[model samples]
Target: MLASLITFFLIGLVALVVLGVVLAIVGAVFSAVLGLAGFVLFKVVPVVLLGYVIVRFLAPKEKRLAQMERKLLETD
Candidate 1:
């Protein structure tokens, strides 16, 4: 019974060590991915803002066209 208990403790210790190592590696990978995602989000935000500005600039002309089309449809 004593030898069996010793064996069980040793096996559990080894398993815990291996699990710790695997978790450390996974943590590093997730940290890097989070950093990359942050960079991409920063980059995309400005482009999106610029796109909105351009659309806003063109909106007046689009509104004029839409109104003309609607008027013609009503006549038909």
Candidate 2:
């Protein structure tokens, strides 16, 4: 009986360890997804916005853009 109890305890311990490993894997995957999303929003978005801003300012303004800027300034 004592040997059976010991075997049972060992099996329970092994199950717990397996569960811990599965949970860890899930957490890691979610964390990686969040990290990628954050990098796209924080790093890539700004780089794209900066490039657009420079192009908009340096290139010749179309009549529409000029009119919008004028309206914005008037509002201010």
Candidate 3:
């Protein structure tokens, strides 16, 4: 009866270890995903938007004026 109880305790301990390892792995994956999303939001998106603004400003004035004219006509 003592041996049976020891075996049961060992099984429970092993199961708890397995659960801890699984949770650690899942937490690491979740952290990595959140880090990647944050990098994209703070770094990539702003750089892309800045590049777009730069390109828009660098465009010819005639094209910009035409766009403004079209917008004015649309509003009218």
Candidate 4:
């Protein structure tokens, strides 16, 4: 009976250790993923959005200028 109780205790201890290691690995991976997501959100996304806004704001003016240039050329 004592031997069986000792064996059960060892098994339980090993199971707990394995569970702790698995949780640690999972937590590390989750932290890395969260950090990368934050970098994209805070850094990359805003730069891309600013570029998009600049392009959108300039495109119509460029088109209008091209049209005026064409008209001037035709008049010449």
TM-score of every model? 0.56, 0.60, 0.71, 0.76
Over the stretch 1-76, how does candidate 4's per-residue lDDT look in tens digits?
Answer: 9999999999999999999999999999999999999999999999999999998778888797898899999999
Off by over 4 Å in 1: 59-64, 67-76
Least lDDT summed over 10 consecutive residues: which range in candidate 2?
55-64
Angstrom error at residue 59, model 2 = 6.0
Candidate that would win on lDDT: 3
Better candidate by TM-score, 2 or 3: 3
> Who is ahead in lDDT, 3 or 4?
3
lDDT of 4 at 51: 100
lDDT of 3 at 26: 100
Q: Point out the worst 10-residue segment of candidate 4 by lDDT.
A: 55-64
Q: Which stretches in model 2 have alpha-carbon errors above 4 Å?
A: 52-76
TM-score of 3: 0.71
Candidate 3, residues 1-76: lDDT per residue as tens digits?
A: 9999999999999999999999999999999999999999999999999999999899999999999999999998
Where does candidate 1 have its weakest 10-residue lDDT segment? 55-64
**C-alpha RMSD of each candidate structure in angstroms:** 4.0, 4.6, 2.7, 6.7
